[model samples]
Target: MAGAIAGTAILKNLSPSKGLKTITLTINNDCNLKCPHCYLQYGKESFLVGELTINSIFNSDFEHLAIVGKEPFVNKSSIALLEKMVEKCYLKNKSVSVITNGIGLTNLNPSVANYLDYIDVSFDGGKGTYHLYRKGSFDKIIDSIYNIQSKSNVTFNALHTLSTGTINNIDDMMSVRRFADFKIIMFSPYLNTLHDGKNDVSIVQLEEILKRLSQSTDFVETKESLLLMDIYHTEQEGVSTETLKELMSFYQLDSKIKLIEKDPLNYGIIRVTYDDYVLTPYESIHPKNYTKSPYLASGVNLNQVFETMQNAFS
Candidate 1:
């Protein structure tokens, strides 16, 4: 994983002189499950506006491509686009990843699975916990995971978001043992503007959860994923800079898990509502101005997009 970071840095330096290493493309906004914490204002209107043509992705210079959305599998056009992109990328020897809720993985057309290198299924927890956040169909999700694993050559990683209601069942979450990879993400209560208006979840609670997760064989001993520390800071106010540094130091000492800083260039990894080719920091995707469809200027050329990003950083 350190190699991934080093490689990213090398690529960042080289990208200005060369080209980008990874490009995350959001194919559509339709989703089967309407998660409570979803940043995308996804509904029929939003979904209609979120569609992007497959040709745009095929023409892009991204070596590693991710097909993501509100629920990428809900949109047949997006899935078709992904199949085409994957086949193209596979022929070119490029890596392709899909971030999905895992609802559509089961019974997927055989051709679709062949194009994917990896699939990240959002498994906040087992049946009970995930239903609290995502509502309705935990069993279906579990079935989807099993079904996808059975059919595809794709590797599966569980993406768990530690939140107020969801964090209590850490032990229960780790009990399920089928995942090839496990990533524990710290939840930002603030992200759900509708529910947690003030977005309050105590730091003591988060630390305790992390401590418990770190000790659990079901979680810590199994495949470890990067800890999202910044999310912890975002929720807790008056958390001095020094305290954050110490917390990071504690994480380094306690776990072998790598810390993935949100890239300044593309915050759309998590929230893919719109497309604006801006050089803004990764965390800045939630900004009002940048969250809509890509500006015509930004969509014109990939080189222009890179130049715009470079200028923003400079």
Candidate 2:
């Protein structure tokens, strides 16, 4: 929650000609750590997906691109994808980002570093738990964060996934302080996942925790965290009017925070795998679900795909 970037825009109201606001590419599905909650467990989906060509991503119209995957930095092919996105997507007036574990950022290619707008790094614990869950050197990740921030112009973001175990340890926040100019966004575990984590903290509980974390560090952008936390809640609960109003009233948040999650699939956010499988609305659809539907294609047309999903969900 320690972000200085502007509040997120409601991507659902995109202009068709301008293309989607953001598309998340799992540039590489191979991860360094095999965490329990990872979504790469669908063997059937991988079996059906085809190769993603450079032209396919470069030609796609989107305002922002999030370069993600098993470990985007570690993947050789992802490095190629990043260079292409920087050359193509950045030149076309699109913003590009990468959500990483903060391990390999210090050694990023100059071309890749030059075009990046944001870098979201993950860390669940401050010093102790950070070592346990992620299985990386805490000192090393922090060094990477510091090195990246010092060497690049990109904004920094800290992403934490909360559960019954790590939520209570607030001291780990000090680890985030190393990224002096960073923002923070904590995530809640979801149901029906490749890894169904234990009981998730409720909307009320998350609100309280976010409020507390906001006060914990100046690095945390409390209001933005509040907005995202609320968005997460709305998405999980189907955005009911009663749940929304009550939660908004509790935090005194404006109604516009409701904008982000309303129609995420059509929100112009597509997640393409290394093999070119389009996973729109990363939150709602699982990687394997594409196998269950005809959505798995050699190449996808977003407008047509959006229309199909909208009609089905509507």
Best by TM-score: 2
Which residue ranges in model 1 land beyond 4 Å of their true spot?
Answer: 1-18, 42-53, 178-209, 215-217, 230-242, 248-253, 261-284, 291-294
Question: How many pairs collide in each candidate, listed in order?
Answer: 3, 11
lDDT of 2 by residue, 1-314 (tens): 11101123222234432245566665665666654344454442212112444456556566676666556666555566566667676678877777777777666765467687777776656676777766777788777766766766776666655544455555564455544556544433322332222223322354454444444543243433323433444455465656656754665454313334344554555556566555545432355564445554346665466556556656
Deviation from native of the Cα of residue 76 in model 2, angstroms: 3.4
> What would you estimate as the lDDT of candidate 2?
0.53
Per residue, candidate 1 scores C-alpha lDDT tens digits across 124-209 of 56655666666656677667666666676665555555556456676666644543333332222223222111323322343554
* Candidate lDDT values, in order: 0.48, 0.53
Pairs that clash in candidate 1: 264-281, 264-282, 275-294
Give candidate 1's whole-model lDDT: 0.48
TM-score, one value per model:
0.72, 0.74
- Write down the worst ten-residue block by lDDT for model 1: 1-10
